[model samples]
Target: MSTLTDRLIYIVGPLKLQNALMASFLERETGAKCLAVEKFHDIQNMDNENTGQPKLALWDCLGNDMESCLSEFEPDFKEVLNHSAVAFFNVSPDLGIEAEFIARGVQGFFYEHDRIERFPQGICAIFNGELWFSRKIMNEAMKKDKKQTGLQTRYETDLSHREIEILAMIAGGASNKMIAEKLYISPHTVKTHLYNIFKKINVTNRLQAALWAAKNLS
Candidate 1:
């Protein structure tokens, strides 16, 4: 089992010195290995071995406005996001895009004026499988969801019985390993089923798939 102490963290930003400083501070506070990367693409090269370990990436907003920050992610953010849980830091207040970030599978937000001491606590919480969202962000995400009473007809017709079972397990917050153990299969097979489920449902990420199941599945 992965514990908080053995997790990995990436502090990705444009400023090398600042990133290094923050990484050092976090390593001291959290007792986890921290790496500072100046370029986002550089992360793909550095860590290739620990696929099963829980990792978090802290992306710097770099004082850009919300729209520009989002546009910066257009190139290859999805691939990065799939590998590690991501949180945005140095964000300005009242961006009104928190809900959008949630839709895109962002796990947390750190505002520009937020206290520096809070970083370690938030990072540790996220590392321990918790979403480090603010109450306002949580409320915004909730308000954006559309409530449904039962499963949708198209989903019932399109998804196979096994696919539906896996989807339900996903919606119930089961991880791949847990699902695999429950269903007498390997984690790779569970991943294969999830990939097919994403394609059939037209969703890009796990959060979207879970939300789809929530709104359309009973």
Candidate 2:
């Protein structure tokens, strides 16, 4: 698999020195070339026609008005989402922008106070085509999913007790490995149970299953 350093990275924010330092650190840590731009318009003016590789954009939201910054960059955000992936750094837990960004296809989010050492791991996960949100954000998403699916009753769906237990864990933002460990089951067994759970509940992904659990199990 290609590492994150193999791709171009753009750090978007208003702080020039801080952004430059961040870019330097990322390059030193990952051996990846990075560009620090103060405005989205700078990115728009760059020539990227030669490299067809998907780029990564990290929006630094520390010490600024999150809502105002996001609103100002909404057009640029959409443009970046068209051909590349976007992630947020220095985010607050209660910023309440996760859902909107998720809806806009954001790939990752890191809390403002999170350790900088985890940046490489998060970036790698995003490069590997996975969502890298904080556990709090995931739990909030689960709650939202659950509330949206709350009209359905348990009696309406004949899910087994084990299935319900697993679904509840899923809604709580537990990974398959975590669930398997907690439930004293093999990962394979968890997968099987999830498949059955999805089929029974007529849902496809973890988000949907979480919603189903919220509606019926809660």
Candidate 3:
């Protein structure tokens, strides 16, 4: 597995001092370079000059009003999604509004009051191309999956169970290789599954599939 030293991590939020302290902690814990940005525009400016390397972003939505912050950050979040970078939300511990952010293409969700020790592990999971949602949030997401029993009616009628699984993983921000590893299948098989999933869902790429999964599956 790769360490955080392999890539850059960007932390964005309205709380400048909090973000800076969090960045410092993360840097010390993981030995990964961390940047604390006050706004999405700062990220955009930095990204323009960034070398093409793997990067992860965390949007801290703890201090501000959730609805207001989400509304203000939606467009910037969409831009992050377009870049295919891993983006997660640092939110209040309550799972009340998680689905709203997930619908906006957030890959992971972290509780603001979680122990700082877990931060490194969560970051490593995301860095390694896996999800980092809290157990409660993950269970809620899975429960939502179960509640939407009529998959055929919700999405394309032709999508099989395995295809739906792949789609959900994609929406959870897993790469093809990661998906294959999790399912104990080869990368080629994962690609084949994705191809069929795209065809069934009438989507052209992973990003489209992800968005579709978020809207329909969740």
Q: Score each candidate by Cα lDDT.
A: 0.75, 0.72, 0.70
Runs in model 1 lying further than 4 Å from the true structure: 1-3, 145-218
In candidate 3, where is summed lDDT lowest over 10 consecutive residues? 144-153
Residues 49-148 of candidate 3: C-alpha lDDT, one tens digit per residue: 7667667788777665666866767767767655535454566665376655544556666676677787888787666545666445655554564455
TM-score for each candidate, following the candidate numbering: 0.67, 0.63, 0.68
* Candidate 2 per-residue C-alpha lDDT over 14-123 given as tens digits, one digit per residue, 9 for 90 to 100: 88898898888777776667888876656666636526665778888776565785675586776666566778888887677786565456768878778888887777
- Ranked candidates, highest TM-score first: 3, 1, 2
Q: Highest TM-score among the candidates is held by which one?
A: 3
Per-residue alpha-carbon lDDT of candidate 1 for residues 115-185, written as tens digits (9 for 90 to 100): 88889878866664446665556545645765322334545447888888988876666667778999999
Candidate 2 least-lDDT 10 residues: 146-155
lDDT comparison, 1 vs 2, better candidate: 1
Clashing pairs in 2: none
Which pairs of residues have clashing backbones in candidate 3?
none
Clashes of 1: 0
| TM-score, candidate number 1 | 0.67
Kindly report the root-mean-square deviation of model 1 from the true structure over all alpha carbons.
6.2
RMSD (CA, Å), each prediction = 6.2, 5.8, 4.8
